[model samples]
Target: MATLSPEMPKSDDRKSSKDVVAKLNYVGEMHDRAVYDIRNPAGSNIVWDTRDVTIHDVRPHLDKFTMDTQGFAFVKLPSKFAENPELFEGNRKARHFVTDDSLDVQYAQEICDYIQNMTGARDVFPRLGGLVMRTSTRASAEKAAWAPPAEFVHLDFAPQAMQGWIDKTLAAKPRDLKPYSRVQLFQAWRCISPGPQDNTLAICDGDTVSSDDKVIVDSMTGDPSIPGNRWDSRMCHYSPDHRWYYMPDMEPDDLVLFKGYDSDVPDAMNAMHSAFQNPLGQTGVPRKSIEARILAFYD
Candidate 1:
């Protein structure tokens, strides 16, 4: 039931202005229903371009993933950008981040016996982060895993900061491994959301807008050969301004929900990347030697 557009000849011109906003709203807001209806069902789903995507249909998926006294929900929308929907192919760098929280996650039944009857998101899930990695063509897996010179080292950040910290790690990584940005990693690990804060509202990314084109999901070709193409959902992933906690995986109907992370390098991420290739490190450079150089420069 989605709105469709006069088709564009190529991928670049495919989306209209409303398409962009719809994609954004989807990534930001759609995933909150798990908390809103922890004990019930979502009123509507924005997919099908007409908001035809409904929570009632998703209930079965929730029933499958829910755990004892808790569960999780996921809303998959179309990609915001049409250039490419698959983020899984390439030499990828992936990590997890819990940037913000949604209001429902805060007041839900998982938290406190004292704080209303709803469960607190923090108690049900805490420090949840996603596992993400860029992808490469089927061919790249054979490359001897890209490695940095002896001077650099690899370290995992606290789960919540993995995505943010990845920028730091990459800048420090060798130029040979730069392609890691393209691959998108899949994270089904467990975790919970941090409590709600001033920025509790979440953001979303969607492929098409309900108001834009009524026929958004329809295809002229009807190419059954195209594996992921026939569907109307957008391929991109992103979340809102709310902060979240990175944790391992949990069960269904639990108020904890999930959405995709915004894929971009932040400032903290860039700084980390900068340190990777500083002049101080080379083939024979001792780890301590390079660390000393970086320390001196920063000091």
Candidate 2:
């Protein structure tokens, strides 16, 4: 059973303190299992539960959060779109992402290069299919066929699922794959919208989460008729020990990189994150964001 925190901040402190109090959805204990249908939420049948918790602003403690320690890191990475917004304006649309355009391909390569430089990896592979745009509003999400900001606390992939991805990726290569000393999967997220986002992502400190706290759930995406649309992800049961942090009023240039799996380290930190409503209340601009998955190999 998950223990509830007795030190939950008061309503006044939540608004005035450095930390913000917000509601985060987690897997309910009532259900022995759960399944999330990403394409069709109406078809999802499971318990959806929420809890009010304090989320600390990470800016002041940026040095403490690193991929090697807390499983996530925040950095200032200027995008080419920022330098010349007009040139790549069309690339923002979901339709352009359907078939990789030259602009999209360039942007993807930029991300790959950045990751390789940051991690000092032998190589970095960007999963083009993993690139996605999300919005906080329903209308934008529906219009673009883009996913909404996920409101639940969960990690992207389980260990077995990550291994499966590694296998498939290697098998598709034209040449034989070489053995690697280490492998790490990462998700890079950035807010494309304006600052003071009404909804921002909150990540739990990996060190605070216990193995038993995670519950494997099926994530179903794409067409229901497809056979390979499902994969295993991890959802959490509430634990008072969980420490959550978020970057408040993030700008377009700010990028967050979090790890999903690590092959070398035992009990490696895996960032568990969710989008939460801002305790300070809504801003004029809703949250618009993009995320990509990248795999890094170290020899």
Candidate 3:
């Protein structure tokens, strides 16, 4: 169960003294289990369970936050992506990023190289990557060529899904001769804006989350019929001990690295994350960002 407050914090409130509103996944209904069918092409007939809105005083708990402890870290790295910014143009890939264009493929590969150097992984493989833009309604945002910020408490992959992805994605690679026994999946996120972000990302401490609080669900692409297996994503039930943190005034050069799945130990499990509404954000220009999902093999 979660500790909730009815009071909401104002935009001008101080970070150390104020509370922030969080839209959390609520799963106390009288159902055998929670599941939704997301297999639709026109962005119609989508079934996303309703979430509960609650105000929380995150200031006091901010002291407990850390990348290793929370499964996320804020790292500063300057990149030359602005020289080829058009690589993210169009929704041709739709919903999620599809790597078809040669330029887009090159861009993803470059990101994979960056991840390898950042994490010092023995080997890194570039997987699916995409740009998410904030536009229109929150519900309709994912279907847009430029998607909206995902405003919910969730993890990108489940254990089952993570295993399947590893077996399939690395089947052709040479066997590991090193003593490393596991693989880790990471998502590198960054802002593409010229200034500070009004809507920013929030991360939850994975250590505080128990197995029972995680609800595994399928995430279907816009076209549900092509490759029928549903992609796995975990919806989190709120808890009082769950600590959340975010980086304020982010620039394009800074990257937010987070663990999506780790095969080695429970302590290094996936990071729970969501985008929150920052009242202090500057208006007129929406937030633009890109996220790259990469796999790192450990020794």
Report backbone clashes per prediction. Answer: 82, 0, 1
- The TM-scores of all predictions, comma-separated, are 0.18, 0.83, 0.72
lDDT of each: 0.20, 0.70, 0.58
lDDT measured at residue 190 in model 2 versus the true structure, 0 to 100: 84
Which candidate number would show the highest TM-score if scored against the true structure? Answer: 2
Q: Could you give candidate 2's per-residue lDDT for residues 1-299 as a string of tens digits?
A: 01111211222322333579999998887555578887788867668678999999776666465576678877766677533443234434432332345555566667778778777888787643546666676343323424677899999788778766776555544335478888888887887767677778998888888878887888887664543467788888889999999877677777777888887653443688998888663734777777778888888
TM-score, prediction 2: 0.83
- Residues 116-146 of candidate 1 have per-residue lDDT tens digits of 1121221212222222221111232222112
Ranking by TM-score: 2, 3, 1
Regions more than 4 Å wrong, model 2: 1-18, 30-32, 82-101, 138-145, 170-176, 224-228, 266-269
Tell me the tens digit of each residue's lDDT in model 3 across 113-208: 766765677878755434444432334232344445666677768877776666655553434535567778878777666444556677766776
In model 1, which regions exceed 4 Å deviation? 1-57, 61-166, 172-181, 185-299
Tell me the lDDT of candidate 2.
0.70
Report the Cα lDDT for candidate 1. 0.20
Model 2 worst lDDT run, 10 consecutive residues: 1-10
**TM-score-better candidate, 1 vs 3:** 3
